[model samples]
Target: MYRAGGTVTGERDAQPGVSRVRRLGTHLPPVARAPGEARAFVADALRSWHVPEDKACDIVLAASELVTNAFEHGSGGIALRMRFTGDCLLLEVRDSDPGDPVLHRPGPRSVRGRGLALIQALSSAWGHRRGGDGKWVWAEFQLA
Candidate 1:
């Protein structure tokens, strides 16, 4: 149980008709010398058993953004994972940053600082969790 705002929180309750795994996880190194390596890890792990190219490409892009975030801002390397619930894939990136990421909408001419926003727009859903030594940022995308 988790307590916040003086209230205790219970574990997630599965819906009566839903059979789903809402969580996925991985424990990655604190620092990846090359973000591409991290991207490859996610791409390979979550690649389609049948549709390798398309899924691998998407995972690579998202993973690149996530691992970059960890390498650039977080204290340690990224821990990445993905889950398949129905037709959705949730990609999670965990890092050693206690503070959550701040996503923003940048102006059209802005040259940087919009990666998370892009992730948010591309994915079906996304969020983060704070851990004792770090934070996790996750995004969910639907498979067509």
Candidate 2:
């Protein structure tokens, strides 16, 4: 079973206008069902935070894409984290692999390579970075 943790706090961001941040996280096994598990985890978190259904759906989709990429291409372990501050929600997925996620533009007939593209379309901003024992691919959504 996976372990989940969270904290609701009134914190301030270093940026000029962000405040009242909340955080949630979970660790998942690298398996075929990781994407579905990620979706559930994110859905629960968003629900607990009282996020709107439409926004929650978008975040869940982004989380699923990130988790699927990690399961398919990464090694070691997988972890997901989310942060909500003011009008922004951030989703991050970390895996043992250090390779960066590539955004591909596939042709109409292509069956694959569209996960990152979908994430890009759904998220306000998205990127990846090396951290700890692996790398984290993150997507941000505007809540306001």
Candidate 3:
């Protein structure tokens, strides 16, 4: 993880395509305030990076949705990680739940079931990875 004001040039043994990387992260409490805190964290990081306002808004929204889902469906501590690759911004939320997120087609009148939909629509790419103890949901936005 890159420290504040530190730079990351990708890890050793990283793919040749990965040139630059910057990362920010925070551990979120398993409470109602997690989502809002996650959003604020993303906003601050993007602002420090000088990301454009429109793009930052989308990234912040994605972070919020991911964190909210983590708390709503997952277990244990929630952690938010944001990384700036050379060409994209990657956001990931990790939780103790081992199950993958479900994507549902909600009815028009439905008030929920749209967080993943919004992430899919706004992000350049999105996916999840499962580990022994938990899983991480992630999305990427183009930096350009």
Candidate 4:
């Protein structure tokens, strides 16, 4: 006997019903503006994805880190995207940077770096990806 555990019940029989929407949302834009733009973008996206307003802070934090990393360390052009995976929201920021990102070693006096550490602490999971082109850094947190 397993419980449903925060899952939205769908149709059990042959009737068509609204299943949980594992919706995917993507955003890409020129970062020629300000810092708050990233926060605004993520907030609007979370609202669209039915994420409660109260939980916006955590999502915003994760989104900020991803976007900041892309803009700070990655290439010139950037894109921000997100999706719903199970009960969590996955956020991604892609760039054309050729540099591979690595998590800074955690130490008591560490101050020069810790972004990845922060993500790992606050988010459910996060990492980066490189393909034939460039790379993308991402993070995920519970949608609730």
Model 2, 23-125: lDDT tens per residue?
7677788888889888877887788677999999999999999999999998866888888874899999998888778899999999999999999999999
The digit string of per-residue lDDT tens for model 1 on 1-144 reads 111111111122278875333443445555555366666555544543233466557666877888788878886656766666546777777778788798978899998788888787677788889866998788877776
* Lowest-sum lDDT 10-residue window in model 2: 1-10
lDDT, ranked from best to worst: 2, 3, 1, 4
Provide the lowest-lDDT 10-residue window in model 1: 1-10
Name the TM-score of candidate 1: 0.70
Model 3, span 1-144: residue lDDT tens: 123222222232266874333776678777878888777677877776779999999998998899899998876878887778656888988988888888778999999999999999999999999966999999989977
Error of 4 at 70 (Å): 1.0
What C-alpha RMSD separates each model from the true structure?
9.4, 4.8, 5.4, 9.3
Off by over 4 Å in 3: 1-21
Instruction: Candidate 3: give the clashing pairs.
Output: none
Tell me the lDDT of model 4 at 85. 55
lDDT score, candidate 1:
0.65
Best by TM-score: 2
Ranking by TM-score: 2, 3, 1, 4
Report the error of model 1 at residue 38, Å: 1.9
Backbone clashes counted, model 4: 0
Report lDDT (Cα) of residue 17, candidate 2. Answer: 70
Per-model tally of clashing residue pairs: 3, 0, 0, 0
> In terms of TM-score, how similar is model 3 to the real structure?
0.83
lDDT of 4 by residue, 89-129 (tens): 77777777867877887688866577777788878788888
